[model samples]
Target chain A: MSWLHIFFALILLPAVAVGMIRILKGPTAADRMMTAQLFGTCGVAILLLLGAGMANPVLIDIALVFALLSALSTLTFVRRTWQPGKKKHDDPLS
Target chain B: MTILYHSGTFFIGIGLLFFLSGTVGLIRFPDIYTRLHALTKADNIGLGFVVCGLSLQSGNWAVIVKLLLIWLLVLIASSASCHLIASSGMEKKIKPWTRP
Candidate 1:
């Protein structure tokens, strides 16, 4: 059982690294947002696996909340990015 | 005697292969859209398999239910988020790659 937990953790770590790369190197804001969502999902999975491995029930609730928040954040970002708007230039002299 | 252990190991191996392929796809894909496609599809399936293997080991009905719920939530969230991101990227006119 412990070995399975370790195996899962090992599998998840590479995903985390790949997600970080996308977040860092993504060509567009939307791309970065997608990468962030990936990280959020992976994070929740890791927490759930850890909880199950350690027999800690409370972590499941925490993971659930994290999943909900991640979904909400992605939705908000998508809405903002998709809305029609003129590009805002931040120039004090304008 | 050893058949059950072998079966569990086979399931775990398949799950690990999925995860590895997903990571490789993420690293090697040319564009954000393609990468998202790979990650959303492969990771969710990989995690699903892993959860199934873990639940088999657990042998607890309550914990199995919880695992299933978590897997469902993950799949839903990942697919929805990926769709939203890809559409938003298209709306923003992010240049898609073209092989010459």
Candidate 2:
């Protein structure tokens, strides 16, 4: 019974692989970072599924932490990449 | 009942299909914005079905509450992250992909 969910967990691997490829070939830096975000969400889903399948509640807690941290990663990305006040006349990198 | 178990499995199967399509769209979509749309929308719904399926299997209040929390948290995070990514792209002035 639980093994079936584990099989489902295994099925999730290819999505992560695809996300990795996007990280590699994504045209823009934001694209790469967004792909990583996708990985984080998928990782959460996989963790939840596996925790239930294996009867290990700890994986669920880890998924909770993973979700919180993934959001942090996005915040870091936006902070580093976006410059709201710097207009066209100003240095774009700043 | 075996029928309930089968129904739960069926729900999970549907969820898996949605997840597959979402990931496929994440890669195949023409641009980053659209790709984000694909992933966030489809994957969120997919995870919903999966949680529903799992809840049916467990029949426990605490576990079900935890599953709901996980879903809600991811829901909030994905949308927030999506906004951040969109704003960053706009900040950098990345052009959207215009359909031919």
Provide per-model DockQ scores: 0.29, 0.46
Encode model 2's per-residue lDDT on B1-100: one tens digit a residue: 6776678778777887888888888788888889889888888888888888877877789988998898898898888778767756776688889978
TM-score of each: 0.80, 0.89
- What's the C-alpha lDDT at position A53 in model 1? 66
Each candidate: RMSD? 6.4, 4.1
- On residues A1-94, what C-alpha lDDT tens digit does candidate 1 reach at each position? 4556666766787877866776677666766776677667677767766766677778778887888788888877766555545333442211
CA lDDT for candidate 2: 0.80
Worst 10 residues of 1 chain A by lDDT: A85-94
Candidate that would win on TM-score: 2
List lDDT for all candidates, in order: 0.72, 0.80
lDDT of 1 by residue, B1-100 (tens): 2564456456655766777677677767898888888788887887777677766766679877987887888888888888766766676687777897
Cα shift from native, residue A14, model 1 (Å): 2.9
True contacts kept of each: 0.39, 0.56
